[model samples]
Target: MIVTAKQASSHCGGHPAMNSAKPTLPAQILSQTPSTSSITDRLWRHSLYNVLDQQPLDRVNVLGDNSHGHLSCVNTLSWTPDGQMLLSGGDDRTIWRMDPDYDVDYPFVCKSVIQTGHKANIFNAHLLPHSTRIVSVAGDNQVRVFEAAAALAHSQSEPETTYSIDQLDCRVLRCHTNRVKRIVTEDSPDLFLTVAEDGSVRQHDLRVSHTCGPGGSCPAPLIKCQHELSALALSPLSPYQFVVAGESPYGYLFDRRNTGRSFDEEWGSLPPTSGPSIATCVRRFGRKTKPRDDVYGTHITGARMSSHNGHEVLLSYSGDAVYLYSTRDNPQDEDEHHGSSIIPSSQEHRTDVIPIASDESHIDVQLAETNDNEASSPLQRATADQGDLDGSDSDDLTLDAMPWDDPSVPIILPRRRFAGAGNVETVKDVNFLGPEDEFVTSGSDDGNFFIWHKATGELHGIYEGDGSVVNVIEGHPFLPLIAISGIDSTVKLFAPVNHRSEFSRIDKQEDIIRSNSRGSGQLMTRGQLALIRAALSGQELSEGNPCNVQ
Candidate 1:
């Protein structure tokens, strides 16, 4: 069902008559009104409307192992500050380092591995912004730090030797009671924050010994919630502020400066009663579902602050949507302070409190009329009536009770105007592309890397990735290159091509994962090699990277 450009042109043969042995004109083409009822045809047209005219990703290199990289899911991917190396962790219970390989035809080679410190699946991995230290959290309820330079120095020079547990310079800390879901870092290499399945957020000081054998002391928890958390991000501007998303309906904001209690007391301090000063903001995306149904409501996959603007919060959800919410002072702030809004008995609000449909339609009109870069977002329109004020005390206002009015509603940004690849998977993460944050990109479960125009809310591009779910898409810190990883276990990089010769053709998935009476094999099978040779000798070839099976 997947048709490449070359196949379409050849099959059409300039006219429909080429396929008609009788050479008759189709009456349907000449009909006055279209009467198409085919669902497949309708779906194709719908998808075309959503697809933006943009460049597709070229195959760079695949990195993984049984013999190739990890033999399981590559759950997390991060780039070093220098952009010369990539870091990854997953179900394999090991950390991998993939560096550019200039000597080989492939763009990257994976050799360095850190296998100790974690005994279960790693959920998050990060390279400290300006340092060689790498921090990771996993299901083992531990947060571990590895010095990359130390590993490289101690590792055997033999290129084929796989670095194992005994070789890594790893420091382990037992912080959470359950699986640590994420780790967010500040500007300093020694300071970082972690959130876990046990609903506790703890701040760690790496200068102190993490091991409890002698002088080691456990760090205190920073913020603890009533439910397990799923995602976490620190504010780009404020060192003491951060956001945490969990199974609860709301994503809570926490300020470490306000907490003055010990671990046991702090963990029991519920907000509005004892910890309101520490818990600054409580925001929800879209409509407010009932307390019993909040668990089933839009489960947030990732919650992040814009790197360039701390006021803007970006949240990606399981419902195939991304929302932008603001944290500045508004008229609603006054209402909460004055206690004027009615207290709903069951935390239900008008279903239309978050006006996404109308706001999106309004944005569509504005885009067509002005085409201005400063087009106001849906958040602006939905909150326009709420009088705005300087965000002077935005950080100080804390309601004593969960506000009857939905804590904060999201301004829904339109997504997937074009037909999505499929609903097989939801996007787990989204990141800003380029320095200006002009474009947004995310990995889909459907084996596609999706890009969106930040201001216009248009689906800008859909790049082909691994044949299976693409779990991660991270743009290089300071380079134009983008790294993508997913079900294939290979970390593929995409960068702008400077010349046509740089475009090396990759074979399609059918050729790579081919099944036969003799069993399946990959990478340019004899039949595929013959086809390539025939094409080089004058046969027409298919468009796009051949390795793409989606």
Candidate 2:
């Protein structure tokens, strides 16, 4: 599985002595040409040889009950800290633990099922770090933290369904007033954050009892918003900062250091001590078409802190796009500001604060319609340069925002329309993969998981799923594996082709072969690229058009 350059050269007969003879320039070109013109540098760099050589992936096994998985869409998945087992929950209102290392013959069976005390569909589930405990939030508007069951002892008898209620204790915390959308944990297992459809963000301490008062007042939210909040992500590096994106196009950043004030009071011209609001700085993405339309009005499905940069965020929109945004140039960047800094405004702030659009033609119309005062609104004060279409800022835009038409906004770079093959049109969430965050992955409505190179936006290849709309996908923090779920009742696991090929083989011939016309054959799990490289360097290449190295 570990391929080295020396091995590749040896397989190709690429010894220095082989090329010592001075050959004609034309012969050299012919010798170096690849037989498959489609093989380009984009395919080979930073990925496995099988993937680079266009070998399609094979499904090793399915995880479910009686060959059928979750009864409803498996909306979310998370891995145990050890990565040996996974925690999956969704519309089924039940959570289950799956062992990725189970034998191929019984690969799909659940190790145990947690009888989530949830009355409605489960939205997300997470295994607490360094413990045999798990916490889940769902449409029932409750957060339940419970101890997970021990692994079933090996037996000659068939495995029995283990229940959370029988083996472990459970604590249900009534925090949010509406359906909880997402939950994120930081350094402490007892302290975590949750966001709800009611547009409220609350922090809960497990040590505190929910029923402190006679009427049983719910946990107080650290911040509240008017718009329905769909997603929330706490910064991994900074303990006090977090970001929330929702139906509105603007993604707001909050600092716990300055809690107890509303966003408007802190960022707006209102007094700093304004009542009942969370004072925070907000960043807007995209532009409004009409004068009165909400600025950066696109609904954001999800947002997360970038592992690469603490100040940057990855946001998924309601449309077929995602944006990597930087918040380095806030008006509140003064040293005195302990929390979210405010972006200072001026006379030029309005006319210069243009929306990031892809089409240049709209620039003229946008400029014409935008007046000096219009650009100076509270939202325009914090316009960080819309990094180029790829979301990488060129030298940093103190105030320059990128146009919406830029190519880097979507899952694919260079601006290609999404070829979604299933019932869903928009992705619900996306996350970075690997320790370096080398790739970005999202679940598609078409029941497939899509992965793209983070830097170049190159299509890494699709992971197939059962025929159901996939809503959420997450990567193991350190492993090469990914867990995805959607309308199907089961959560599916995917790993690199090389790794899966070593574990199991599907007996059905049709399942072994990829349906895609290109690279349609049994995929090579090991070092097949050395053979391809050897063939290209030897005299076996086609004689025609050697000069065309593209």
Candidate 3:
């Protein structure tokens, strides 16, 4: 049931056309029109979900293994900070490493295998910063650290047709007791953190291990700021404070330095609880509050505190309204500052947005507007709601939260205005363009991908996502373009030959523009090469990489 029709259809000939009992497209189709019995042709209905008609597509790579097909992609991914290799784990309970730089046949080599064996696929994997070690949490209620260099060395040292899963060193970390839904690490080399389905954030300090004995234990957490939470981000700003924003009504702020540790002999059987700081933070503050309204709320899928520059911090969250939080430094007096607003303002938002009732803050919403609403492209909208952001308390725990910068600092608004570039008018998975600010990409439920520019928010390209949700999209580092992965288990590479950067002559300008903008979607596959490479060269890639890569 987790696989979409788009994925299913990739194996069959046509899309698994929706049954539409009353012309009802199955839940798998992306943006849909509410069906009425009067609708007749079943074939025409497929047009609405026709991914090929919508977005740009180029090349595809296939993945295969001895997997009994029980393993499925968990749909989450992370790249080494170096951006050289990509990592993916799935419902199959294993983590995979792919090299976009290679040809499709050898596009990726299996870098590591996590056999800590959770009941479900591994959800997320984080390659630690400044280190080759890897940390990940899976549907199995465990977070683990695997020695990357050791695995790579072992795999390289071997000469067999296949590497044994038994040879990998995966430690079943007993930190989170719930499904390890997502994991994020500090850009710093020493620490790593994880969050679970139960909504708790746990920090792991790797230093204490060096001091312990053969029969000894590692250091206990420096601090655990407890909240029913989902995702957390260590501020990219110099202050080094981290925030976890999710299902919880309020976010937690931790000064990493305040998270000092003590050794615990009973740590093995210790149940995961709100960390030691819970009592202190909650006692000083009031009971937890709910998140903002629907336009500003939803189970937040992702969030990042952007230093966009060292002078200011803007926290942009994606859910309903794409929110931007701005904060700045004050020199007059440390405490002489104040923040704008923590609540949503109706004036700055689209009137068409149905603001959730103030009291009913959290509700799983089902849409009622499929008949008349329709907009495929982003339209720029203006606003005067400047400096509206959540500020910090100038109190004790916080002032020490970031000694590098004052805790109460609020960012001053720059006159550089931002017009709201509209949205898809449909649910889509938001993805990061590369850090270089070249492009931002997202995929809709219907297997379509949209690429948007970072500054002006103008959409660069829209393409059909094969027949599966475009779960992951990455840019090729050495070349001019991109690589895409989907729920259908196919990966592809893409490029832009029509760029102005490479050409000086304006020959056939109009024809070139039209082709790149709206070319007939074609896919190139080299899966057979992949199989041969894995077979002859003994790379981690299995002969399975050569599937029907349509």
- Write the residue-wise lDDT of candidate 3 on 1-550 in tens digits: 0111111112212112122111112222312323322234223333422322233333332333333221554455565544355566666566655432221221233333445345666656767877766776776667767656544333422321222235545555665656766666766665777766555565667653422223334333323322224555544444455545443223334455543333342464432332344211210101101121222222333444443242222222222223322233332222212242221232322212233233332422324322133233223112222222223321101111111112232223221222232122222234444333234455433355555554544445555543555655544322223445556544443433212211111233233223322221111112222333344555553212100001
| Model number with the top lDDT | 1
* lDDT per residue (tens digit) for residues 414-440 in model 2: 121121212124336877765556666
Candidate 1 C-alpha lDDT tens digits along 175-253: 5778998888887878888888776777777765544423334544665655567788776676666877754444555
RMSD of 1: 21.0
Displacement of the residue 320 alpha carbon in candidate 2, Å:
3.4
Mark the regions of model 2 whose C-alpha exceeds 4 Å error after superposition: 1-58, 65-68, 100-109, 149-158, 164-167, 212-214, 260-279, 282-297, 329-427, 498-550
TM-score-superior candidate, 2 or 3: 2
lDDT scores for all predictions? Answer: 0.50, 0.49, 0.38
Q: After superposition, how far is residue 267 of candidate 1 from its true place, in Å?
A: 23
Instruction: Show model 3 residue runs off by greater than 4 Å.
Output: 1-70, 100-106, 109-116, 130-132, 154-165, 187-190, 209-227, 235-239, 248-254, 257-297, 305-321, 326-431, 472-483, 498-550
- TM-score of every candidate relative to the true structure: 0.61, 0.60, 0.54
Instruction: Please estimate how well model 2 matches the true structure, expressed as its whole-model Cα lDDT.
Output: 0.49
Q: Relative to the unseen true structure, what is the C-alpha lDDT of residue 188 in candidate 2, on a scale of 0 to 100?
A: 76
